[model samples]
Target: MDVFPLPLARIGIIGGGQLGRMMAKAAKRLGCTCVVLDPTPGSPASQVAGHQILGDYHDPSKLRELAEICDVITFDIEDIDTETLAQLEQEGHRFHPSPRVLALIQDKLTQKQAFAAAGIPTAPFVELSEPSPEAFAAFGYPLVQKARRGGYDGRGVSIVKTPEDYDAHLPVPSLLERFVPAAKELAVVVARARDGECRCYPVVEMCFRSGENVLDLLLAPANIPSSVAEAAVDLAVRTVEMLDGVGIFGVELFLTETGELLVNEVAPRTHNSGHHTIEANVTDQFEQHLRAVVGLPLGVTDQLSPAAMINLLGAPGRRGRPIIKGMAEALAIPGVCLHLYGKATSAPFRKMGHVTVLDPDIETAKRKAERVRDLIEISAEDHP
Candidate 1:
């Protein structure tokens, strides 16, 4: 299908975080205007958006106002109440990826069920009334208990390694899943248009911090066998098709020691793992998402270089404002690009920003990314 040119439309984004900021920037590049609805005045997206609507996500009046002003509505965060989106849809407002998709993916239990219903393979899981002894016994030891909703970036997730740990944090309803002994973690970013056209970026291998779910490094065009990479991309494509997605979809996977693949989770937006595409791919994930959501034909997902992305998290004891040190030294490295989210405050383990390093070889990019990560520091006193 040919690209549908909607006349100079204004898009309304629900969250004003860094993702929204980047998405808005991409929209601007495509000759569209963005109006961000966020409670905070100085949000990252608001900083770049032409208009800002200050209101809560659940406020119908605010949503109606946004619907009236914008031609299409989308979201940066999935935590918003889907009921409100559904209500807006009833009034002829357009929402990309639709409210039904958001409702299915917002809760871990619901997401898992949807995956199963779609015939997608995922780790075995059981919905528990509470993370109690009985729940642990049912799922077995060394399981992961995840909150049904509102979890991201290593929060609302816990590993129940033993009975004692399970007993310690009981009485909360959670989803218990058998923990796969993953040899490596991989992720694929897939983009789909409203007309069913889709494309998937090269698979990325993710390295996590020890004993934590936080990603430390992401290497694109994963250093794996061709079959494994193909399988990962296939899974991502099938998952997005099942969701009837109309924008970027991130599929996180676990590659087991026996070379089996299991779906870990999915994010219905441009993801952190795909951030390297901004500097390394012909068409970045942010731009592809805009194209998909706005009924434009999806862009090519070809890689321009072997890239590595290292997340710059706020260090321990860092508070107040952030001071990035050695940025000059880091930028001195060839093919290194630093991107810091314009956040004013820093807290331990908070995702301040990321740096993407591109090179002819993956190993060289990885080493350069590590050096760049070491050079950047977040001090408490330096305000944005």
Candidate 2:
């Protein structure tokens, strides 16, 4: 096997969220610098990055400055204006996963169609300019209406169970999708290099709370039939091939009651489900993403142990700086790792941090994970 040299001294990240913060930390470990561009002065990534560029995504001058300073650019969020990025790319800026890939995945309608065109199976869906009663009738009731652009973490997504429910929330441009009756939700994280080399991590089974997926409890190396796991990985690889996707691609899937797997969605970067890989895999997703984007050799995706991840969300009816009421109790659990994103304010349904637990057996890991999750509680109160 031929070894590839690392890129330049510094890499630029377009978002200053927790994902970017973690990526910056990984880069620093490799003796590389990470420069983050975000409008917020106190953004999570900015706190850890070697340098920070405070500007809006639409500011071309700032983009050009970032392009001049860093070897390659990648994004932690897809909400950035791709048109501007495309212009920068033409002017000698190099972007990972490419602006074209970001453009396609930013819009839910285009993303779903891309899956079908790639010969990937996904739930039936129809695009809508206005989610009216008649439009809802076409897709049938108990369907999901999601904004084509700028939706994440259960926001801008709603279920229309009946005609009355549809009438209540009208005048929104969204996509109506058939809600697949799923037995389990699974996800696979795949990383692909610019040279087309790719590797997939072990599959993860996900559980949602209260019809909203804000809180995730992930079971790694999902205890599914071997055939099912293989199929999931195959689908993920195919999707990456179709997009010519670079860096980490997270393929969210639905395992139906009929033993069929359907692609739910694709996130073009590191994802929350892959968070367990940080402790359980030979190489974590952040490093893999860096390697892929910089044209380096991909890392091993083999699992070292069974793991589970629980997301901590802020409790409702409370406001201000967040506090984990039972942090010491949760941290006391053996083999439990907690990661808190440094955010000053907390609101209902906001993702504050995550907890990961590992064990030799999947069930035991899940039990320990639940215990840790139960012990910790996030309240929107000022923490002295």
**CA lDDT of each prediction against the hidden true structure:** 0.86, 0.87
lDDT for predicted candidate 1 compared with the true structure = 0.86
Error of 2 at 110 (Å): 0.7
**On a 0 to 1 TM-score scale, where does candidate 1 land against the true structure?**
0.96
Clashes of each: 0, 0
Span of ten consecutive residues with least summed lDDT in model 2: 1-10
Per-residue alpha-carbon lDDT of model 1 for 1-384, expressed as tens digits? 555464456889998888988888888888788999888878888888868999887787888899888888988888887898898899899998799998889888999999888889899998887555775876688888888888898877887788877654535677888878899999999999998988999999999876557999999889999999999999889998999968898899999999998899998888988999998998999889988877777889899999999988888777888877888999999999888888778888788889999999999999999988888887676454
- CA-only RMSD, every prediction: 2.0, 2.0
Candidate 2 lDDT: 0.87
Cα misplacement distance, residue 159 of candidate 2 (Å): 1.5
User: lDDT at 239 for candidate 2?
Assistant: 88
Q: TM-score, each model?
A: 0.96, 0.95
Candidate 1 lDDT score at position 216 = 92
lDDT measured at residue 315 in model 1 versus the true structure, 0 to 100:
81
Candidate 2 clashes between residue pairs 3 or more apart in a chain or in different chains: none
